[model samples]
Target chain A: MTTATAPAVDSVEKPGARERAKRPGTGVGRPGFAWAAPAAVFFGLFALVPLALVVVLSFTRWNGLGSPEFAGLENWSKLLDDPVMVKSLWLSLLLTVLGVLVQTPISILLGVWAAGHQRNRAVLSAIYFVPLLLSITAVSVLWRAVLDPNFGVPSQAKWLFGDGNLFGVQASALGVLVFVSTWQFTPLHTLLYQGAARAIPQVLYQAAQIDGAGRYRQFFHITLPQLRNTIITSTILMVVGGLTTFDTVLILTQGGPGTDTTNSAYYMYQKAFKSFDFGMASAIALLLVLVASLVSLVMVRLSGYDKMRSTMEGV
Target chain B: MALSLAACGGSAASSDGGSDTIHVLVYGDATNKVEKQLVDTFNKTSKVKAVLDTIPGADYQSKLQTVISGKQAPDLFFNWGGGSIKPYVDAGLLMPLDDFIAKNPDLKSNFLPSVFNTAVVDGKPYGVPMRGTQPVLLFSNKKALQKAGVTAPRTWAELLTTVKTLKAKGVTPIALGGGDKWPTQMWFQYIYDRVAGPELFQKAVDGDKQVWASEDSKKALGMLKELIDAGAFGTNYDSVKFTDGGSPALLATGKAAFELMGSWEYSTLQDAYPDFVKSDLGYGTFPTVEGGKGDPDNLAGNTNNFYSVLKSTEHPEAVAEFLKLMYSDQFVKDQLSIGNLPTTTNTPKFLDGSANPAYSTFQYDLVKKAPAFQLSWDQAFPPAATTTLHQAIQQFFNGQMGTDAFIAAMQNLPAA
Candidate 1:
């Protein structure tokens, strides 16, 4: 009897138990679908319905007031010839790249350094989180005021530096817009990166340092690799945010000075509501969604979400 | 679901169609005072209740469109008639008020024929004119005008001379709110009418002539360039909000000598500076072009506000009743007294006689005297072209593109 029990235990320890769990409708199989039904309903109603409508509308013409008429790929065809829309798409793409490439690195470095000082971490996090807490409208209004030619920071700076307004130059104006956007967003990225940096095990750093690795080398060799999933997620979110940016641009510039800073979202709004070309607006929105989805899909594939999930489970 | 929906439907119906309640959407906060007085008086005198639903002008059009297209579009909602109402009317969203108009001899007789004509499209009257606003002359600081030694420009030559004089004084001769594209376009349209005359302007509106490419348009553009060279606009004018631009700031501060804004600007002034209407304000039409067809006295404004009934209504009579209440003597009196120029042919004698004196002058000349009206450029053009006009004007003023390019771009705008 003891020998038979030992054999059964060994069989359970073998990969057979894992295979059984993987089988359909087993112990670790799909749980009661009741738990998922609510979420599925929510996603269906809030996300899929609108997305499906948008996709359908992309193939039609609607004035937002009257019934839509099917136009096949006419909206898509028109998109190829729309210079204003093309320009907006390019700007949104550039903003996304800037958010990930330029903004992510600085935020990660700042976040890691800030995370090192435990005594002041809470206060520092709060400081970094302040911009995120402010409403988009509030943030935009604040920046607009600060960037005003007659009474803003740049104007005062010029006076202090001996001159009239410093806001007239194109480069200066562009710089202010970029600076305001980055300043408002960097803190949020920092908070995300800081959390990622903290979760990195101390043992890995210890072993690296004991082997004569410098702090920077330890970070590069161990800490950075551990934060791969976090970095990817944060960068994706920031890029998405950058691509859809509207309120700030609207409040600050209103796509004015001859459409200097018109983003895709604002362009969509101007076309649909302002000009009453709802069909064209839907086309623009569909294009935006497509581009964002492609970018996210590429990031997900490269980052190995399954591996990241396993690592998260190990923690 | 059935129970809840039934409950909601019952409550909504009771709240909406109940006697003693008539809902009306008013345009802006400034009109809320007058609108409410009318509503209150109507409610007090009759069992039919009247309520004012005032929405900010910025969000009014979009919101109104939404309401009209949905299950509820207030019993009677304010409409800026003409082209803006065309889409709604064409969609069969608005109830034709012809039957009501035919029945009510009082409203028919009270309104000016020209003003009433705007509410009629495709042989159907969908709305009734509440007010008639025309372009009124405006001057900035008396000090600036005195320094320029020009009283007020009565003709094209005098305008140029006065502008030059003001420029010589290092003051902006004209404070055109180029930031608000509509104002700049108004100047162009006014000049175009002056150069091409009312008949041609009518032709232009009918799409028979591409006015943007016409000689009158060229002359108008040249005049704009002249104004631009003379530094007629405020600093960073392209960035200014419509309300905050040249009028309230530059004009109020006396930084500029004159403006050619709508009569509504008077209400704005009254809000900005107390006692403005009573004493400080004056009005005139756009100066007559030297050899143009439009008379200086020939007006370029339409009824800026109209109230329409929804065609979806189960109670068309109620909707008409609400509109009738709006045109009632008490209602017209309250509105007219409060800066609004009532559409009434003879505003009830009870209405305050202190009508915005400047607007009253234009109203007398245009609504009472002018031969025919050239509706506002925005009000006359299709929505797509109208939008193009705004952006074209903005780019033109921003020095982004030349006037020829601007006009050419406008000609290429998609027509309905």
Candidate 2:
């Protein structure tokens, strides 16, 4: 081939060298520019841009319509004195604590029982998972019907208990709600605990039995210690889920009978969508996220998930 | 090369030129065959091909707003009269029909005066009213009334008396679907108008007077409380859906004595009871309160739906032609026979009767003799105000706030 033709071939083979050399910042020739582009774009747009916008918008008074003005933290300073926020925050914590305390032991007991029974385990598991199959709205509606003072199991229960029509508030209503929630979510924790329980070497239990450890003793020592990680994980989940509960509370009580049952999430919906106050809503959302994060962090630390593997490996 | 290819894949389909297609969005099931018949009639007669895309009524506002903001809006769509269309108007997303009306004077004159006014906002017409109806009378069952030995409630006192008697007879006096936030406000607003008088009610909704805390307002809330206490709303009141509540079980089963519903409810009841059209169905205004200024004849409600053309349309002329077809004389007659109060000035030839006897009383009260008409409170106010009113009603019902506080909260709300 002639020299000019050879130059043409080189041009074809190695295009954009001059262009690449002149590129700015990370530079075109470097792997950093090519590799970091997607992540950089994502982090900048999603994380940094939104965070900046939220911070700026937090101060401004915009009613989710029209252009927002630079109100200079007027919304933020107003957040300090909002009574709804205080009530909602307390309500959220109360629900979380109540849910966890009520649900955990029932889940644990069911988990332990099911672990020993192999024949009906699948059937039992399916039965336990039935609640998960129903959508939150459907579940709320079902429970509402089941707790109806005039038509529900409570009225039937009243008849059974001889309390009859004399009963004022259906005492069974709150209990039924808690029980249904546990029934719905317990299967998840049960499976986790069951898996963890099975992982405890059968030899350890056998050895403990041989060494004069009674069933209760073996349970307290070997079984409890072995399931610590699973319990901590499940507890964290239940606590967080309960803290952010919305659909059930909204559909069931609508924070009704005078806000007797309004949780923070439902309250936030009432404030935001129902009331259309984006500023107050955002403040509540941020507060909720902060509280959940702090609680989850404390839980992880107390559960020793930081050193969970090391402790497990040592064991 | 791959990135560009993916971008190409993500791109939306662009409409080619000369397409005769016009998209028309509606909400809810075409309640009757009226909308379907109208659309079909337009497509057959007109050059423009119109397609109806129906969304649930509850989600229509939010969905339409998104569609408009994204600039993928339909050619023509449904809107509530003028007030609800303001949000879109302010954004310059609605076509002004003044020029169209000027070009077609006959079409402009076709609509009733009240009907035409609903489409005019800021002295410019945006929507064309299709069918109008008043929500004045509630259909009541006489069997339940006779058993309770109570007369048809003509005043607020008579209504409460009926409630007590119905409870004694083991029937629910009234059925309300509080699960729908809008209906809860309906009960509150209905009482608000009846007790405070219609002028004050309109003034409050228009941001001129704050009536939420007026003695009349307190009386309304107190009346509602009385109903709740007397078992008017029934158990699981919060769980009932609106469409299901006002008609199905309440009017059809006869277990409930009265349903505070709109004129369209007559058809629903007829569907449930074959003889409903001929026998035993009585319609009247919400009863007046003792010593209250609210005239028994004061009205509340609007025609069912309005149609507006999108500002981004390339075919404004075609939209005007389509609206003319909808509001024309022939279309008006068909709609009126089916119990729709047509917006057009077309006279009806009713084989059944020129007057829908059950609805005429309320219509007369609304159109002729009524001193004032109170718009649906939610539809009348801006979104923020609507939300505040909803919350206030809920809070009041839950006993979270007293009547004075509720009024103060509404009175102090920043103007839209």
Best model per lDDT: 1
Candidate 1 lDDT over B227-306, as tens digits, reads 66666664455544444433455566565677777777776777776554455455566787788767766667655578
Residue-wise lDDT of candidate 1 within A1-315, one digit each (tens)?
Answer: 343345445545777676765666452323456657789999987788777877887888876566788999898898889777788888777766765677788888978877786787777777777887788788876766555443345446764522222222333334445666788888888888788888887877787778999978888877687777878878778878988988766776666555656779888888777777777888899899898888788878877864565444443
Local distance difference test scores for all models: 0.67, 0.65
Looking at model 1, residue A286 earns an lDDT score of 87
Candidate 2 regions exceeding 4 Å error are A1-69, A145-180, A254-262, A267-280, A309-315, B1-21, B32-37, B45-48, B105-109, B131-136, B209-236, B239-254, B267-282, B333-343, B350-371
The DockQ value obtained for model 1 is 0.25
Highest-scoring model, DockQ: 1
Model 1 TM-score relative to the real fold = 0.83
Candidate with top TM-score is 1
Which residue pairs of candidate 1 clash? B20-B49, B21-B49, B22-B49, B137-B284
Query: Per-residue lDDT for A10-63 in model 2, tens only?
Result: 544676845644655323222335456788899987677755665665666654
